[model samples]
Target: MNDGLNPAWLRAFVAVCDTGSFTRAAASLDLTQAAVSQQVQRLEAECGPLLIRRTRKASLTPAGVKVLAYARDMEEAHARLRLALADDDPHVGQISVASPGSIGLLLYPRLLALQAAHPGLSVSYRAAPTADIIAAVLASRAELGIVTHRPDDERLRTELFAHESLCLVVPAQMDDVSWPALVRLGYIDHPDGMDMGRRLLARVHPGQRIDQLPVRGFTNQIGAILDPVAHGIGFAVLPRFAVQAYPRRQAIRVVDTAPQVIDSLWLVTRAEWPLSASAAWALERLREHDWLAGADAPASWPAHDNG
Candidate 1:
């Protein structure tokens, strides 16, 4: 007699086991509850009773206990097989990446180039804040995330992607670098300004409080923060990536300070989920980018340690 084993039956069995609820398994697999039940019944017929019923739940029978191990192994093999097939045509898959608006601005050109190089590949990049990027990666909405800070979560695997130096930016015409001149210029505060603000305060006036510093302007948008500074309204401190690409870069320049401030960029992905072939390829490309080498920028930004 034929074993009559089927991948769908195995998938349904594993989904139910993983979810612990047939209803939840059905919803997760996008299959009808009746359909999932039928699939499980088919598997049970093939391998004897697989699940033992309990109040509000189910447990694996001895047979299911054995079958689950084999089912997972089979799923891994299937995933590898799909990956192998995808490798033959790396240009035919999709990968999603999430980054903050500043990083997105710096990465967009490279993303366009990636798509151009592989016409069949689809790339989706979302501009979100660090918190939102982490949430997107955890939710499986995004396969990769790049951000300035890493969270202390065991579920995330982080690597040092790059180091971006912070710079005090003033109107291009502002030539004075004295403390009095800076105090007169005041600070253009934004949502991301707090960290830079604190660092700037420590460097500008040691032992002085942040509230003691003059606040000239305020905004929530990163891109908008630079415009006022460029027009001689007030000065703001920002990451090199955010400032270097501004269309009006010629209008503002980095102010050399006694102690330099730097922000390290981290690449993060969920530790539990294996990357798909396309995502892995994209990640490799990103890893190979020249920025990771950190040669062009001045020595103000130090290399990151361990991740």
Candidate 2:
């Protein structure tokens, strides 16, 4: 916009589009919700045509969609400029990383160790889908990415680090690991959109009704799935790491079946750009994880190979 609108507002507008929630946008920009809303409003005032719809959740107005494409380009260019400047001065630099919530969650604890191992290293974290992580790291928006899937691009170096696999989580006293019982009781599904959960269900029971599970509730959040299951209400198919991290894990029992649901975890970085000391040190520390060093045999997770 040659209208001399603030670049900060433009950046905030783009983050809102990416996150689809003002609250998440606020978190992404490290700003208050009101602040983000005001920036968007300021941008809209310059446009004066209701750029954003501002629905109950989040929706882009017709004009909002039109501008988002270009806005994203601008935001990316700004990041590149910032990185170029930071490269000139090593004293102030940033490393942005994108990861799915599961592996992303575990990686941070290890990242803390990495940070402790090195001082004056600034790290930024973003929770994003697999494809976005691949794209971001490839584009140099992020120097490195901790993702579950491997990128096919030869320009990026990918290493299998740690894995978080699905384990059958049932109540501590519930000894019934029978498929029939699980089928009858309706598996408490965690709609995390992860492949392992779906694949394991297919392996154990093929040609079965997937939608109903007879009658079960679905939750996108892992905690929602684990809480009810841990209380003996129902069983859940979850990553071992997730089960172990559950608040009341002692009340639950893990059934790591022979054909485990394992998704390979990978570390990806652009080959063209050599990692800085901070990033290189972090990568080395990440490689030290014993869990990532080993791969679990998930019956059939061929689809995970695509990314």
Candidate 3:
């Protein structure tokens, strides 16, 4: 009859074969026996004789056996399609996010915990600078991004997600963070070190530029930026989250400043498309942290140990 098999006809045929009786199949399908018989006849019209023995008991021909397997496969595929379309479960999908190294240091563990809690969920976290994060979101490489500043692009929607304080870190043995003291210690610079240093140091050391400090060492790695500082080589400025994650944190001291210098962290996404269920779920989970609420005060340094 037609170019394609009618799903209704195949369903009725499969039901009849499974039940082994027309009356039982009709009851299972919630159809009259006459209606079920008509559907079976329609299937036979499309593919030639299917049922050779149709009495109180039904028997399948060779062609009917082959069609039955394919019909069952189609039913299974249809069920999977319905499940995929009804993607209401937020805890069972993939999410991709990009952020600066400092933010990543704080977020990666949380996302890992989320994935651990929901084994069906998967997370892809990329540690990148502001520019790279923007690029990744634009290119569709990442669905979510975290940046210190709100992006100016019309394509991106940004919301203030958190406030990250810039920290001036010195060696554990150091006590005084006077301008002259910092000058003697020099500056351990990283990619964002000079900028962060200038922003935070500007308040304390008025009229002094960050470049005025000698550059004792340089590292692009967020974790290693504090290494030289921890070893008593020089001082550096870093995000509080990055400072908190250092393995040798006790070796370095975070200098508490009056009128703390803080950077607004923005969550970014494409303006055109709404976030998927998984990404939205992840965003909510990330917002649950107290630090993300911008309530974190400057951390007090541990007492200096001369020994």
Candidate 4:
């Protein structure tokens, strides 16, 4: 019964709610703070005062909360409309995806090739942590999320993508060494390195008394972590995707002494909505793309253990 409630106003309100701050919402929407605030006020005038109160964070009044869901529904409907109509036009649809850095690196080139083929398809891609990727999908900010972990939430659906092998990498100049000797070499820790190191040691050394290994260097960036290790600063545990095509891969050797570890990749989306045609097309290509196509499986690659 709300007449003339502009879609722009609804969009602005949804942006603020999603970001939890007018300033951030304005930034995300590329609108000025005053413009965003004006849209909220305009929306409230049409709907009889939507926001109830404001403190450290924006809290939607009961009316605002009700409106929020409707607003998102409208937004999704509009996006799907564009996608459905875009099929005939080719250039009218947009596809957004969220993924982790290494997977993003692996797929970005392929995605570009896909885009080139479609000419009309536009892509919005972001690389973030696994949790953030899932949040993006749940919030409907991304049409798909390519992730390493399969979330257990009932609201999400997942499809298996691939299995990435994990291996221990050392400076090529370093000789084959034992656990304690490797520990003496120190560690170049990335975000996942510490946990991977702990597991690797447990699997290889069995009952070794080591509580923790010394950390020589640290970086969160996937590709950046390898340079220090290649320079002999320390050793690292990394996925094959991160190490295989590394520019300096030849400078580092993949150690085969440790048992092969594997990480599963998954494609996730909200269960509330079906995939748009554009999303489905891209997902098929992503699944079919040979991620490990040309790359040589390391000689030390171990067979899967049924136990």
lDDT of each: 0.79, 0.69, 0.84, 0.78
Candidate 4 per-residue C-alpha lDDT over 190-307 given as tens digits, one digit per residue, 9 for 90 to 100: 8888777766666777775334668899999877889998888888887777786588878899887456566667788989877777777877776675675533345466533211
Model 2, stretches more than 4 Å misplaced? Answer: 1-93, 116-119, 193-195, 205-209, 289-307
User: Model 1 over residues 78-129: C-alpha lDDT tens digits?
Assistant: 8867865666555666778998777677676777678899886788889888
Models, CA RMSD each: 12.2, 15.2, 8.0, 12.8
lDDT of 3 by residue, 1-307 (tens): 5778999999999999989988999999999999999999989988888887655777888988888998999999997677557767888777899998987777889999999999978899899988899999999899999887677899999887666778888999999999999999899998878788888899878898998999999998887888899899999988888987788978999887866776667889999988878889988987876745432533562211111
TM-score of each: 0.65, 0.61, 0.69, 0.65
C-alpha positional error of residue 72 in candidate 3 after TM-score superposition, expressed in Å: 16
What does the lDDT come to for candidate 2?
0.69
Candidate 1: misplaced stretches above 4 Å?
1-88, 292-307
Order the candidates by lDDT, highest first — what do you get?
3, 1, 4, 2
lDDT of 4: 0.78
How many clashing pairs per prediction, in order?
0, 3, 0, 1
lDDT comparing candidate 3 with the true structure? 0.84
- Strongest candidate by TM-score: 3
Output the TM-score of candidate 3. 0.69
Q: Which candidate is the best by lDDT?
A: 3
Clashes of 4: 1
In model 2, which range of ten residues has the least summed lDDT?
298-307
